[model samples]
Target chain A: MTRTLLGVVIAAFVVLRVWIWRRRRATGHERVRARWGPFAGDVGLVAGREMRERFRGKVFRVGTLLILAVVAAAIVIPTLNSGKAQPQQVGVVGALSAPLRAIVVASATSAGATVHFVPEPDRAAADRDLRSGRLDLAIVDGRELIVDKPPGPTGTSATAQFVRAVSNDLGVAEAVQAAHLSAAQASALAAARALPLQSLQAATTKGAVHTTSLIGLVLVFVMLSQYNTWILIGVMEEKSSRVIEVLLAAVRPIRLLTGKVVGIGLVAFAQATLIVAFSVALAQGVGSDLLHGTAPVLLASTFAWLVLGYAFYCWVYAAAGSLVERQDQVQSLAFPLSLPIVFGYIMALTAAGSGSASELFKVLAYLPPTAPFAMPVLVGFGTVTWWEFLASAAISIVCTVGMARLATGIYRRAILRTGRRVHLREVFSRAAG
Target chain B: MASLLELVGLRRRFGAITALDDLSFSVPGGQVVGFLGPNGAGKTTTMRAVFGLTDLNAGKVSWNGAAVGPAERRRFGYMPEERGLYPGMLVGEQLEYLGRLHRMSGTDAQIASKMWLERLGVGDRARSKVEALSHGNQQRVQLAAALVHGPELLVLDEPLAGLDPAGIDTIGGVLVEQARSGCCVLFSSHQLDQVEDLCESVTIIDHGRLVVSGRVDDLATTGPRRLVVRVEGDRDASWAGGIAGLMISEVNGGEARLVLDGDVDSDLVLRVAMGAGRVTKFVFERRRLSEVFREALG
Candidate 1:
């Protein structure tokens, strides 16, 4: 009876706690709802239109497919290469003296290596392989054990032992020739214990680093370029179509702009997220190791910088769109506006190649224009401190606000200026007035 | 009728060209006002200024006796001269999108959209994309978008410009219906006959300034009415001119047509026609609005 009473009390307490939690959650949700309020009718209207238009647009559909395919390749190729075995090609440089060849092959077998005896005609090629880190060791002249600089006797011990046995057989044969030893006697001497020699390392770790960084480069570039251009072209199209005019009529220019930045930022994120998830699935399913040694923080930082970069650059593109009245003007305007995107991309590529952030890159990490490129690199190489990242993020946020406000001012003044391209001074002066 | 919209001294300039010079007009509720001008005569500029699609360089626009901001302008529908409509969108769907822009929810917008499509004679075209629709059907969709939210006033720039006879008739009926529903309908057109046929009132501008504005027939006549006489003349054309205030403007097929001075009485034209021959017809031109329009403006 006492145990039953305790269980009942505990059940009641748990229920009470859950009820309080739900109530608080509800009230907190209500507060946020009241705080954020409902968006003006035009914002949703424009976003819906943008969503429909882009979803149906040929450029968007086809471009998305191509990018998805590329992401799939990046993931699957490496996973497939992960299983490739380093051929245990041990090159025997001299005329094989058949028994010596057998010992080298046997040692390679114990080491789980695949042995190759180079023909005398291909001696030069075998030497080149040894230098190039492909061939493990060269059993030269049935005596000399040649390899790339030995790994503190762990490598040469096997090669040294194999060579000494072959030399001992030759010594025994010479003794028999002076006092004439038989082939059986020479064979016994060859079978005895030989000196320690090391074997060369297998090509196990080759191409792993090469493929990983390649994937990173391609992934970072395609994502940044595709989404950033989306911002530029999307804004330009909206402006030229005079859709913004109707949109601004309903909401304040700032709200309208904010909603657009948020909406498309979400869309870019969704695209990146899908590609990442799909590629990860494809890699795991296909058994590829292309992404080996890559930092997870690199993916996280890439997404973070994507958002920051889009926020910082979206206002500029929107402002540029307001400056032009015609479609042709948009093409010319995009190149100049896109220089920062291009420069940042190159800088990020260089950082990836060097595997470290430079001073200029560190400074760029703080600037809103370049942070998208620099932040990802810092995160990848483990070079950035938390405070540095926070500073960069804070700067980007502040700049986004300022740029949005400035853009609103210009768009308000310039969107209606349709007869000619509006000069910056005109938009500024008109705003002031 | 109460004034639905009023523009006071709406002046604007584009570099060296003065697009609107002290332009002003008022559109009262349920009134169909024809805005008439030649090309580059500032008709579109004035309409755009009233719609707030262009910033007023030097004037104010009042809606329902209150100053209109951008928010108020959203409630006012405007059909620009260029006929802006997204081409690839479906006809019914585009109207719904535009309706939502003016604050209708999706389902409500769709309901309104269907009703408008039926009303515009495009019920069969509801599912067709705008680019797939004929140009005339696209125009109907454009009109539907402009009217979907039931705005209190509509500013149409050359709604009749590129229509077939049937299309012109259909749109004319639509404009009249809009006016009858207590919405102020202000549309610009170069078709004088259409202006005379559809508008109760009209404003004509030439060279960036007001030429005349008032009741269409009244504004077309600048002076007192004159008697127009026709007579079958066999003998002397000189005898027709002998009557005071009677001048022969044309003579053909043994018939003489004469314009009388505004002060001349009808009996004098009868007397003058008797001198020409046996007066087969003695009728005065019934102030043909076209003649009056030509006499005053042309």
Candidate 2:
């Protein structure tokens, strides 16, 4: 009887708490309305609607999952491959002293690799082993090195650097033994350092930075295209469905458009943040050096450019969306609209792949359409300064403002003129008249 | 005195075509006004202009004696002829969202949405997606969205275009109720019969110009009255055509309808019919608003 009474009391307490919570929520809504006035309130309402719709949409959920899978693959694949990397195997012909083997091992260790040296009777046996995949490299009489492929001048591969270092050390040891130098002299000779390289021009090539830039470029491309298309298709759907008419009745055209862009933009940014956070956390967990050197700056720049790129394209796509009344028309319109984006992406990818920006790419970096791609690549290459990035971003922003105004005008005029797809010329003519 | 809603000298041009030419009209508070016109007669354009959707070359739309702007428009509910709601959105949630857009608090919007859904007879379908509802049900949801905010003024373009008889009656009742509660209602429709039943007043336009506008009774009464007479004896009434001021508009089965000249009296037609034979039925009646519209357009 006492337990039953306690249960009843608890249930009543729970009901009371729920009632209080609902009341608080109701008052909170009222407070928002009172604080923001009708214009902001309407904008917020429209934005809230967009956000809610997107959150509940299957397309958004599926697209986010797909992109995240791609991102995970991009980050995890290389780390897994590197974790399973094989040690470099060297086959030595003729006599190889213990000192020489020690030097090779030390060089390999310094270059962040493992080496296994196998002795052979002669050059023929060493060459046979190297050709038959029993060895990665063959050293003949401790003087000549043979490999399947020659290293580039940049010495980008750790194995190539290790081989060079080992060969140099062997040469010094041979000369010292030939001179019959005292132990102290030999020690001093071994302690000598190689000359530092001073170049007349700045070095533009960095393996890690180049890879990060390429990845960043691809990320920016995928995200800008995806989110901008969302804005486009979303606007088209709303316009075709005549929801814009209902929305326009409550808020001004500009406010409605602004709310839509902002709402979708926030969704895109949130997804990007999730992907980045996941990539960072995963990279840390796997102890990958893929994101080494200026990684934070690269990430920040990539995000900034993603925003600028999206801002520049979203308005254009939305305005185009307003001109059409059918889903099929969206496809016809999207191709033309996406031309610049695709072009910019390809150009940036080329520059990133070649590890240097072309003069034309440098020029494109200042233009809003291509800057979102080119500028970030330049930043990663260490070819652009902070002010230069700022200048390019400012230019893009100014252009975006102009585009936004023009797009708003187009949207307001064309969104209501349904039935047939409206011509751009017609919209302009109507505006002028 | 300033009217509840007023449009004065509204002139709008699109390229070489003028959609509205010096169009002017007003709706008094607590009255339902019908906007009638032939196709491409600028009814939709004028309605769009009221919501400031169309740019005017020269004109003004004022509400409550103040220039209509976004603020005033926010309080004004509008249903465009192309009835649209997000297909993926649930009916009740969509209504509440629209209510919020019109500045209703969330809780108020929720209650109003529920009340309208129930009132519109779609209470159980509130959680259903709009596209999942039948066309008639979708129409009801559309109306609910418009009324969810309890708008001060309602403008609906072609509100009953594709509705069945029952749907039409339901919408008419709701609109009448709204007007009775002091919400000025303006609706456009091609259905003249529905308009006659619902509207207290009407404005008809053709070629972007106002053809006729006034109280339904007044507009019907302004035109010449017709006289109908039937004789008990089997006789033709075609002779009534020969009357100096009476033009026989129709003659069939001993009954004749005479269209009297402006100065002619219906008593003369009745006397003429009485001389021909024992008069069985004589009645004087004003034209219907539909006939008035046709004649005005002609």
* lDDT (0 to 1) per candidate: 0.67, 0.82
Would candidate 1 be rated incorrect, acceptable, medium or high by CAPRI criteria? Answer: incorrect
- Give me the runs in candidate 2 sitting further than 4 Å from their true place: A1-40, A85-201, A430-433, B1-3, B229-244, B248-257, B262-281
Evaluate candidate 2 by giving its C-alpha RMSD to the native, one decimal.
8.1
Clashing pairs in 2: none
Model 1 spans with C-alpha error above 4 angstroms: A1-40, A86-220, A227-263, A283-294, A325-327, A417-433, B1-3, B207-209, B220-222, B226-228, B232-261, B273-298
Q: Number of the top candidate by TM-score? A: 2
Candidate 1 TM-score over all chains jointly: 0.74
Give the interface RMSD of each candidate.
Answer: 8.9, 5.1
lDDT (0-100) at residue A221 of candidate 1? Answer: 59
Candidate 2 CAPRI level: acceptable
